[model samples]
Each structure stands twice: as C-alpha cells, then as structure tokens.
Target: MPGKFVVSITCAKDDTDKATVGFVVANAAAASDKDTVVFLSTEGTRLSQKGYADDIHEEGFAPLGELMASFAEAGGVIYVCSPCFKKRGLDEDNLVSGAKVVGGAKLVEFMSDGVSSVSY
Candidate 1:
C-alpha cells in the first residue's frame, strides 16, 4: 500500500481560502511520510509562478507562500496544468522551485496506480 496523496487545486489567488487549504493538506501529507503531489489547474496554475503565492494569507492559516515552500521542502511535488499555464501566457522560466508544467496525462499516470485525492 503505497501512501500517495494527491491534492488538486483549481483556484489560486482567485480563491485564496481553497488554495491555501490545499497546500496545507499537501504539507500535512508530506509530513506524514506520504508521497504527495499538488496538481494545479485553471487559476491555480498561477501558484506555480514564483512570487504569485507570496501575498495570499487565509485567516487562521499560515501564509500561502510559506505553506507552499514548506510543502516543497518536505518533498512534495507540484504539477502545473500545461494548457492552463500557456493560456495565461505564463513564463516557464518563472516556475517555482518544485513546480513543473505538465499535461493531464502526467497526473493521470501518477494516480493510475491508486491514490488518495482531494480537490479544492
């Protein structure tokens, strides 16, 4: 039983609370020694950009940027939606340290083997 956790977030600053909580869950999963991946799509693709998460802070939670950093530091993977990123004209060079733009198939492959996933 491989403990793989997938947190799929479809909102970014547009829905700070959801995005913030998503990263929070990712952090927890990573800390618990689970293989964790955060799949960012739609507006959430913006979070893959360095500094885009910097100003997001939901009440009663750590700052969004800090949560994202912690999750990465804890060995969490961040998969950004390729098409969504390109649609917004985002620069690949500006991706955050642990984020990579990928097609949906990448995510499908990760979950194909069985995973626990939650969406925000």
Candidate 2:
C-alpha cells in the first residue's frame, strides 16, 4: 500500500516562511508517490484562495504559488478548514485547484488509516 502523508499548516501570509516550507515538504511527499494532503487551518486557510499565495516567496525556496501549483499537479490535496474559511469570509468559488473546504470529520477520516503527519 502507498504511504499517506499529511501536512497541517496553521499560518498563511502571517508566516510565509513556515507555510512555504510546509508546502515544500508536501511536494516532496507527493513527488515520492505518496498520498499527500496539506491540511490548512486557522490563518493557513487563506492560502486555499486563488492568487493568495502568489506573492509569498522565502529566500532560497521556490515561490509559494509555484510550489502549490506543482503540488496539485503531482496529485496532492489541499484541505481547507471549513469553519476557519467561513470565519475569515473566504470565497469557496475562488479556491485553488486541488483544494477543497472540508470539515474536521473529513480530516479524521483521512487519518483513520496509518499515516505520517507534519505540522507547521
């Protein structure tokens, strides 16, 4: 069976460095042929929006937008926290490709199986 990789990100533009690194790891997992999910919560939920990641780039790393697009191209999932998204008034229609607003139950279901998780 394939390995499952989960990356939980709780910061968005508020902490671009952490978010960028988290996606980099997630891309690596997906590139390794694992089932990868980037679970975005709190401030991180904002990243699910189209163009939100466009301006974020950390030194010595790929731009956040490019990393995100590559992750999606490599079959990674971006799970946005529903409540957090709504609380922040984000538009679901504008979510980036491969991203979906989901509840905690959805995350629980994904983690019900044996998996590795990292948080940022």
Candidate 3:
C-alpha cells in the first residue's frame, strides 16, 4: 500500500504564504509516490473556488492556482472542510478540481491508520 501524507491548511487569502507552502509540500509528497491529501479548513476553504487563487502568486514560487492544479494533477487529494465551507457560504458549484467537501469524521477516517500530517 502507498504511504499516506496530509497537509492541513487553515488559511487562504488571509495567509497566502502558508497556503502556498502547504500546496508546495503536498505536491512534493504526491510526486514522491505518497497518497497525499490537503485538508482545507477555516479560511482555507475559499481556495476551493475556481477563481479564488488566480491572483495569488507568492514570490519565488508558482502562482497559487498553478500549485494547486499541479498537486491535483500529481494525484493529490484536496479535502475541504464541510462546516467551514458552509459557514463561509462558499460556492459548491465552483469547487476546483480534486476537491471534496467532507466532514471531520471523514478526515478522522482517512488519518486513523497513523497517516502523517502537517498543518499550515
């Protein structure tokens, strides 16, 4: 079975640096053959919107949108927190590629097997 890795991001436009780096790490894990997941919560759920990341470009890194797209293209999963997303009134129809709206139980289930995780 493949090794599992999780990058839990809790901020988006509010903290673009963290969001960018989280996706960067997620991409690395995915490229290294790990089953990578990026859990978006709090303000981070905004990133699931199709055009939300379009203008965020951290210095010395690819644009935020590109990083997210690359991570998904590399087979990484993006888990958007259901409560947080709903609380923010984010558009479900505008969800980006590879993003799934899920509850905490889903997160727990995925990580129950001792999957390694990081938070941003």
Using lDDT as the measure, the top candidate is 2
TM-score of 2: 0.97
lDDT of 2 by residue, 73-107 (tens): 99999999999999999999999999999999999
What digit string (tens of lDDT, one per residue) describes model 3 on residues 29-114? 99889999999999999999999999999999999999999998998889999999999999989999999999999999989999
Clashes of 1: 0
Q: What is the C-alpha lDDT of each candidate?
A: 0.93, 0.95, 0.95
Candidate 3, residue 40: CA error in Å?
A: 0.2
Over the stretch 1-120, how does candidate 1's per-residue lDDT look in tens digits? 348999999999789999999999999889889999999999999999999988998999999999999999988999999999999999999998789899999999999987999999
Whole-model lDDT, model 2: 0.95
lDDT of 1 at 21: 95
Work out the TM-score per prediction.
Answer: 0.96, 0.97, 0.97
Give one clash count per candidate, in the order shown: 0, 0, 0
- Which residue segments of model 3 deviate by more than 4 Å? none
Question: Once model 1 is optimally superposed onto the true structure by TM-score, how far is the C-alpha of residue 24 displaced, in angstroms?
Answer: 0.4
Ten contiguous residues with the weakest lDDT in model 2? 1-10
